[model samples]
Target: MVSAFAITRFASGLISGTLVDKFGERAVFSSGVFMVALFTFLAGLSQSYEQLLFFRAAGGLGSSMFSVAAGSVILRSVDDANRGRAQSVYQGSFLLGGIAGPAIGGLLSVISLRAPFFVYSGLLLCSGMVAFFFLKGDKIGKEDKNADISEHTTVREALAMKPYRIALVLSFIGAWVFFGLRASILPIFVTEELNSTTAVVGYGLALSAVVQGVILLKAGRYSDEKGRRAASIIGAQVVLLGVLLLTFSVNFWMFLLSMAVLGFGGAFISITPASIVGDVIKGKGGKVIAIFQMAGDAGMMVGPIIIGAVSDLFSYRAAFGMSAAIFVIALVLVYQIPETRNVEGPQVKNLRPLDEDL
Candidate 1:
């Protein structure tokens, strides 16, 4: 079931980004939200496993659409000067929702097993309505002076830039470590290796989220002020340190401390990569943004399976060492890319035509 949803979401990412470019974010965003709401509501009413699976898979398309459009909206609406801060707030909201969602679902489950789904669907519907009503005008940002709304940086053009290429790597690493491996492997490691309970896993995760949430705004501000390169390098180093800590951990306190460190690193990861993408494109680049989103999604999908395999074949320490190695590579790449805090406006230079390179 999980695989079904992830596969469909991954498959639809490019298409959703293209659609967002053509139709604009207001329509694409609302439609995507509505589709998720509709499918989720149907899933809630499903009488069989097959029905639930089908609904969840179909919802993945909407999820892709929503995610790509949301990124596009952020890229389009926010200027370079404040983009990092904007992304921080955006990511922080998701963190808040992540913390709240399971609890809310648990509460709703007391009413009925399906109650949470229905309520979630209703909330999505409300959000869609809000997007439809509030996301008015063609260009939301005052700095967006591109007379041609149709003008967009192509994927090839975006990839040609050193900063953007590095940004994609950062995005993938961020998702792989923070979203994928941490969620999937850490709990098992806690129970089996640390001789801890599931409750400890929950506490560890919550502590990580709290630590991450606390630093998000500050991280964003730092990215905005210090430069994306600095943020990315620091984030990668800290994440590597955290992973190494986890690799050597023998007690619950060390595990919890590593989680906190990882969380602190994650805030910078969440902010800088997106900010770098925004810095590169500086305007509508739905396909470009889509590719960026896909990198992270791909990481989220692949990280667990591969890392879990490593754990099964060798040991948890080896698996974590592998992750740490990857971060080391990412950190080196971060050093190669230029700072992008001042890379603003619609007229980016040296971008070849889309057809010229491919």
Candidate 2:
């Protein structure tokens, strides 16, 4: 069931991006949210596993649509000077919701197994309605009227740039470690290797989320002020340290420390790569943004399987060491890419011409 949703979401991402580019973020995002709400409501009423699976998979289409459109909206609306802060706020909100969502679902589930679904569906419907009614469509591409032809970047053109190519890799690595390998393997490692309970896993994850959430805004501000390369190099190095800590950890305390480190470093990575993509496009490249989104989704899908296989064939330490190696590669790539901050105003016109090698 999970694979079904992931596959569909991955496959539909480009379609969502195209729609956002054509219709604008407000319309596409609202329509996507409404579609998700309808499908989720149907899922709650499913009488069989097949029906539930079908509804869930169908919902992935909407999920991809809104997710891509949301990224498009952020890229289009925010300027280079404030883009990092904007992305940081966006990520921090997502972290807060992620931390709270399970708890809310648990409470709803107490009423009935399907209660959470119903509640989630209703909330989504409300959100979609609010967005459709209140969001200003004119703000998304307000600068497009005066945008030079060079301001519009195609996916191929974006990929040709060095920073953007590296940004895609960084996005993949970020998702691979944080969303995929850690989520899938950490619990098992805690329970089986460290001899800890599931409760310990939850505590560690909660701690990580809390730490990440608390630091996200500061990280964003730092990226805005210090430049993307500075923030990304620092972040990648810290993440490397955390993964190494995880690799060598022999007890619960060390594991907890590793999680905290991962969280702290993750906040930097979470915002900077998106900011880089936004910088490259200068706030108008739906197809370019879509390809970037697809890279992370691919990481989320592939990372667990590859890392888990290493764990099964070798050891948990080996699996973590593998993750550390990937982080090392990301750090090197980050170092090679040029700083992508403060590239707005008069300098914007020279961006493409400067990257003539691409």
Best-matching candidate per lDDT: 2
Overall local distance difference test of candidate 2: 0.85
lDDT of 1 at 231: 84
lDDT of 2 by residue, 37-133 (tens): 9999999999999999999999999988888888988776766778889999999889988989999999989899999989999999998998788
Find the candidate with the highest TM-score and give its number. 2
lDDT of 1 by residue, 58-80 (tens): 99999988888888877667666
Report lDDT (Cα) of residue 9, candidate 2.
Answer: 84
Give the poorly placed runs of model 2, Cα more than 4 Å off.
Answer: 141-150, 343-358
Candidate 2 scores a C-alpha RMSD against the true structure in Å of 4.3
Error of 1 at 272 (Å): 0.5
The ten-residue window of minimal lDDT in model 2 covers 345-354
Prediction 1 TM-score vs. true: 0.92
Name the lDDT value of residue 210 in candidate 2.
Answer: 90
